[model samples]
Target: MIKVVKFGGSSLASAEQFKKVGDIIRKDETRRYVIPSAPGKRTPKDTKVTDMLYHCYGQAILANDDDDCEEYQRSFEDLIEKIKERYQEIIEGLSLELSLDEDFKVIKENFSKKIGRDYAASRGEYLNGKIMAAYLGIEFIDAAEIIFFDEEGNFDDKKTDEAVAKRLENLERAVIPGFYGSGPDGKIRTFSRGGSDITGSIVAKAVHADMYENWTDVSGFLIADPRIIPNPKAIDVITYRELRELSYMGATVLHEDAIFPVRKEGIPINIRNTNSPEDKGTLIVEDTCRKPRFIITGIAGKKDFASITVEKAMMNGQIGFCKKVLEVFEDNGISIEHMPSGIDTMTIFVHQDEFEEKEQKVIAGIHRAVEPDFLELESDLALIAVVGRGMRATRGTSGRLFSALAHANVNVKMIDQGSSELNIIIGVRNHDFQPAIKAIYDIFVNTMI
Candidate 1:
């Protein structure tokens, strides 16, 4: 059995964290492929290495200007020196013979040449992977050598799979840096932030591993935001569709994009904690017959939404009326999140931040297109999604949800549910968001007795 494990920045933030990660990997023989992220914060006030690199590179770019070239050059060099010192400290703490002198030399040269920001940001993961491999006595495999991107900047899945599969098949064990791949021109390109998770998923797919383990600071995903529902239970198992729904509403532990790669290959991801490896954490799978502990799997919500409500007589009989209304939003570059309609009324929910500037133009366009009898715009809305597969089997879930909200005295602004019965989205005033989530959790979880 083979397992591919990826450690987040928090898991390898310091020498102490590195030692913990090493022990976790060594304790399990099946963990043959490892992925390491850049160093993160040692304390709440500490900065991430990737953020530092970005800031330093910003200074390097400014150094090209002749007006203050000397000042910017010194500033950039100071940041570089700090980076080097931090790595040296980690090396000393681990008592590793490896010296990063040549690595630092190459970085200095790259900064002088201004290779690119992607190259600069990726150096964190690259250098960390080197240290991890050396400390573990395993081979170091660079992600750029395997993961490929096309000239258009799209990930080349077919090309990457062949390259990565063939390469890892020949190796017994290896550590590959996360978050970056090589472009068609052989220049480095990076995924979006939290991309190390994506890299781990790609590696797991390439190796066809039995399971992919993601080690991070959190034990797992909670049923609701702990700040809202104190000591919420951890989700034992969640399906890919359910996870996507919750992530959309704001429960973000794993990068949402990370699910696609291993999901297609039918590989389950185990979200584990580096600090407490004994906990089972959360298990994400494509499909499962396993029963959920509660009628609702999880609750997540997002704020700052505005809804446009349009009412017209005989709207149900008027075909294409909704399409015309939606086209106005599309033309204005605003996307709709949810649309709950009655026989004569329809409300379009959109992000307030996106709709605020163009509200007048969009309203005018809708007036010309749909010619509704009455139109109203409301902002400062929050949407909460209660998602679960078990919801389909459980009757009166909606009734119970409304009951909980009424008890909490939070008014419901809107309600929508998919035909699949996988989720129910409730809209409330921004002030009532947290209380609504807590109320729902209590009815389903706390009051279970």
Candidate 2:
């Protein structure tokens, strides 16, 4: 049983952290393929290596266009020295006989060559991977060599899967740096922030690993945000659909799109805490027959949403009415989050930021499309998702949610549930977001405990 372990920035921030990771990997021989992120913040006040790279590259760009670029050049040089010092500190701390002098020279020259910001940012992972490979005494495989991107910059899954599978099929152990694959031009291209998770998932799919272990700072996801609900219960097991629901509502433990690859192959992902390996953490699977511990698995919510309600007589019987309404949003380049309807009324929920910019255009488009008898727009709304697999089997889950809110004196604005009964979405006022989450947590977790 092979396990592809990916350590986040915090887990590989320093020599001490690297030692911990080394021990974790060495203790289990099956932990073969390793993915490493660049060094993250060593302290609360420190900046991430990736962010520093971006800033440094920003100075480099300014230096190229400006007539008086001495200051910008100096600033870029200082950041480069700082970054090199960080790696040197880690190398010395580990007492490794590795020399990064040549790599640093190449990086400095590449910056002068204007190799693009992707190349600049990717060097963090590249350099860190080298350090980790040397420390672990394993073969280092650059992500650029295996993870391929198309000419359009979109990831080429077929190309990447074939490349990674073929390359690692015979190798017993290796370290693959996360983030930044090779583009069609053979230049570096990076995924969005928290992309190492994507790299790890891709590797897991490539190897058909039994499990993918993601090590981060937190132990696992809690039923509610800790800031809102103190000491919230940890989720032991969650389905991919449930996690996606919560992630959309703002739970945010892993990258939103990272679930796709491993999910396709039916691989379970274990979100483990590097600081506390003894903890069971959270397991996210595609599907499960195990019963949930409570009627709801988790509660997550986001604020600043606006809902557009359109009412027309006999709307349910009217063909293409809903489609016409959706077309207005699609035409305006806005995405609808949820659309819940009644016999004669239909409501569309969207992010307030997206809607506020094109409100008049969207309203005019909707008016031209449906010509509704009544139209209303509600803003500053928050949608909370009460999600669980057990919700389908248990009755009164909605009742309990409403009761909890009512007791907390938080008025509910709208409620919608999917047919699968896996999640119930409740819309409330923005001011009541925290209170409503606390009330729901109290009903689902505190009372049970």
Candidate 3:
């Protein structure tokens, strides 16, 4: 069995943290294929190494008279030097007697002079990878050489697959950096924020590992935010569909698009805590997974939303009413989040920010395109998503959710349940988000526990 372990920025922030990660990795040999993220903040007041690089390079773009690029270079050097010093300290602290050479001095010096923003941003992972490999005495492989991107900056799966396959075919284990792959022009291109999560999935797919372990700060995916619901239930196992629904609403574990590559291979990903390895964490898997006793897995939600309601007689029969309502959104550069409707009324959910600066135009567009006797716009709304795969298999999950909310004296404004039955989204007053989630979680999870 092979495990591809990807450490988040927090796990690899300093030499001390690096030593902890090393001990975790060394505890099990199956954790051979490793992915490292750039060092993150050592303290609340400190800035991330990657963020510093971005600001430094961006300053270079805007450096008029200050010639701050050189100064930016010093901050950059300080960040890297700090990272190196941390690693060297880890090695010394652990007394590993490892060679921290062949990097930073020669290879890094040349690249710093002619590096693009993506390359600069990627150095966090590169520096962390070097330190981790040196501390662990493992082979260090650059991700840019393996993770391939196309001309338009989209990832090239075919080429990346072939490269990673060939690279890891002979070698059973090594430390590979995450994020920032090579572009078609041989320059560097990076995935958007949380790109390291994407890199871990890609590598998991490339090597066909049995499981991918994402070691981060959290123990696992919780049913609800602790701030919202104290002692929230932990989802022992969740299907991809359930996870996706909750993630979109506001689940904070992995990026919403991070599991695409490995999803197809049927490889399960574990969200583990580097600080607390004993925790079972959360197991994300395909629909075929049969573990977990809860009929409703988790609840996640976000605040600050607006809902536009349109009502017209014979609305269900009207051919162009839906199109006109959507056109209103399209014309005003607004995107609808959820659409729940009845025979004569339809509600379009949208982020408050989308409507804040452009609500009048949207309302005017609706009036002009699809005039209705009853049209109303409401704001200061929150959406709570209750997710579970088993909810579909067994009935009454929706009934239980509404009943729970009712008992808690929480008023729900709108509800949208997909045809897939994986999640039920309920719109409530922004003030009710916390109580509503806690109430529902208590009924579904606490009753079982």
Candidate 4:
């Protein structure tokens, strides 16, 4: 069995932290393949090394106007030197001899396209991978050599599959850097934000990893936000659909797009805390391998949503009513979030900030265009998502959820459930986010799971 473990920056922040990481991996022989991120901040006030490099690259491009090339070269070289210095310090602190001098290749001076921020952001993983491989006495495989993109700025799945299969099939135990890959033009390219997570997932899938562990600072995903619900229970196991709903509503443990590759192959991705490995972290998978235990798994919510409720007799049956209503948002360059409708009324859910200055104009436009009987705006709205896989086969899940909320004396404002039945979203007052979350958690996770 093979395990691909990816350590976040905070997990590798200091030599002490790196020691902990080494201990964790050594304890489990299956954790043979490792992916290391650039060292992250040890404290709140610190800045990430990747951010510094991006700024240096920005300065390099801005000052290339002199034509003598010294300014650009010096600026770029300064960033490169800083990268090397960071690794040097880590190696010395850990009392390890890392061969980064040969691996750390400088970006060519006159290269016209610097490959955008992806290339700059990806160097963090590259440098850390170099240090980690040396510390572990393993080979370092550059991700740019394996992950590929087309000339038109698209991911080449076929090429990447072949390259990763060929490469991993040959290596026994190695560290592969995450984030940037090579495009068809043979330059560094990257995916969307959190590309390192994407890269790790790709590697896990390629190697057919038994499990993919993501090590971060936090213990794991909670059933609800602690800020809203004090000391919410931690989720030990969650399904892919349930996690997607929680992520959509502000869960931050795992990047949403990072789950696809592993999910496609039915591989379980574990979100664990490097600092406290003994704690059971969240296990994300397709479905319950054990049993149907709970009616609901987690609750998450976001604040400051504003809703515009429009009411007119037979509004759903009216000709061109929806088009006219949408044209007002189109004219203002605003997009509706969720539209819950009925025969007489429809409420458009949008961020409060979006309608800050244009509420009056949008109202007037709707008055003249759609001619609704009444148009009113509700602010300070918070949306909560109650998600689980068990609810799919369980009857009265929604009824149970609403009953729980009602028992807590929390008045529900607007509710929406996807026909998929994986989750139910309820809107409440921003002031009630805490009580609502705690109330739901008491009924669902604590009582049921």
Best of the candidates, lDDT: 1
Separately for all candidates shown, the number of backbone clashes (residues 3 or more apart, or on different chains) is: 0, 0, 0, 0
Give a tens-digit lDDT track for model 3, residues 145-164: 89999999888998998899
- TM-score of model 1 vs. true structure: 0.98
lDDT, residue 347, model 3? 94
- Which pairs in model 1 have colliding backbones? none
Question: Candidate 1, which ten residues in sequence have the lowest lDDT sum?
Answer: 60-69
lDDT of 2 by residue, 1-449 (tens): 99999999999999999999999999999999999999999999988999998888888777777848799889988998999999999999999999999998888778877889889999999999999999999999999999999999999999999999999999999999998899989999999888999999999999999999999999988899999888888999999999999999889989977899999999999999999988889999999998888878999999999999999999999899999999999999998988889999999999999999999999899899989999999999999999999989988888898999999999999999999999999999999999999999899888988
Candidate ranking under lDDT, highest first, comes to 1, 2, 3, 4
Give the per-residue lDDT of model 1 (tens digit) for 1-449.
Answer: 98999999999989999999999999999999999999999999999999999988888888865545699999989999999988888888899999899998988888777899999999999999999999999999889999999998888989999999999998989999999999989999999888899989998999999999999998888999988887899999999999999999889999999999999999999999999999999999998999999888999999999999999999999989999999999999999999999999999999999999999999999999989999999999999999999999999999999999999999999999999999999999999998999899999988873
Once fitted onto the true fold, the runs of candidate 1 whose alpha carbons sit more than 4 angstroms away are: none
Error of 3 at 414 (Å): 0.5
List the candidate 4 regions with Cα displacement exceeding 4 Å: 65-83, 99-115, 289-294, 318-333, 357-370, 392-410, 445-449
- Give per-residue lDDT, candidate 3, residue 253: 82
Task: Please say which candidate is ahead in lDDT: 2 or 3.
Answer: 2
